[model samples]
Target: MTQTPALQMTDVTLEYPDGRDGTLRALDDVDFTAEVGTITSLVGPSGSGKSSLLAVAATLLTPTSGSVRINGREVTELTEKHRAGLRRDEVGLIFQQPNLLPSLTALEQLVIVDDLRGKPRRRARERGAEILDHVGLAESCSRRPHELSGGQRQRVNIARALMSEPSVLLVDEPTAALDHERSEEVVTLLCRITRERGTATVMVTHDTDFVPLTDAMVTMRDGVLSASAHRGSPDAGSTRRSDRPGSSPG
Candidate 1:
């Protein structure tokens, strides 16, 4: 039997009321999926509905029609309460901006989410420590956002998202603000974590440089997704010890 996809969107259509009180289809019949331990990249122009797709996949928006499945469970048919639960328990969203509270230390940024979820502060911090350490932020745990570099801040953001142990990860323009070097690092980190944790990751990136790092690349145009493509950049498949950060020799 075929392995079940970690995330699925089938014939999804999302519409909004135009200023003239007419329907505007932001997403039209979009079908997509991200399998376990795989990274899928979405590329498109502005207003091409990439963000909208992310929103739907994240369970932030219900589609006008069609289905969305998370971990093989159809979520589009779920009630808002159930959808909210799925969002909290199963989906990890990495926004374009780190959006970290300057007042909070890098570790605190992650523990707070657990606190909100009612986990005890002590346990939460322990979980935070494990996740941060996984992301190679062990030494910077006490540093605030300003104390860290842009790449480090993004690592915190990525770590925070993974704290939930999510089955699916939805990232929005994660490389929009960083320079080429930082951008590449962040993408590499994403690929590493996705494979390591067996999370199905769907990332929207404008930078084609990140394309080759993904398991598959799908282009979206005018709210529609095309067939699969690959960049074959050696990192396109599963991760290896060589692909791990700090593994390269100077």
Candidate 2:
């Protein structure tokens, strides 16, 4: 049997107000999807609307046209409060910056998330510990963000995103700040989580070095998706791995 896509964007468009009564199209009729239990990487230049696409999918921004669907629900037309609810309950976001609070400990970071959802803090702490361990940060749970390494902090961000059991995980440049080894490790972890948890993951990154690590890759340019690849099939990303620099043999 075939599975439904975890994320689905249909002809989504986003516009920003340009100066003096003009509009800039940040995203132009882009369509994409990430299936559950798979990882899809989005690659693009700095101003290619990658972030705008993510913000729209995450319900942080509304599209000017088209539809945004999560697990087959058309959320583009939802009210602001409903969109916020969808984000809080159905979508998990891993920002480029770890974005941990200075005063909160690693575990507290997640506990606070539950509080925001009107859940009990003690109950959330139990869930937080399990997720912290899942992200390999169980040992650093008590340490504050300032006390952890860059990679550790990123893991904290990942754990916090999953703390709510979201169906779709939206990750932004997770390895942007890490070195080569750390970046590879984080990428590997992301793949493992997607497979193990059966969650649909969309990762946005500039590094072509790790493209092979994902099940598929989509390249965006000038607010449009131009090239794409898929794994285990006749797609650009999987069939032509040897062509990529630093790609290891399967």
Which 10 successive residues of model 1 have the least lDDT summed? 234-243
| RMSD in order of candidates | 8.9, 6.3
lDDT (tens digit, per residue) of candidate 1 on 55-147: 999999999998888988998888899888889899999999999999999999999999878889998999999999998999999999999
* Model 2 CA lDDT for position 215: 86
Error of 1 at 227 (Å): 2.6
User: Which lDDT tens digits does candidate 2 get at residues 1-250?
Assistant: 8676778887777888999799999877776777788888889899988899889889898899987889999998889999889889989999999989999999999999999999988889999999999989889989998999999999999999997798899999999899999999899999999999998888999998998988888777777764466556323222123234585742
Worst 10 residues of 2 by lDDT: 233-242
The reply for model 1, stretches above 4 Å from the true place, is 231-250
lDDT of 1: 0.86
Clashes of each: 0, 0
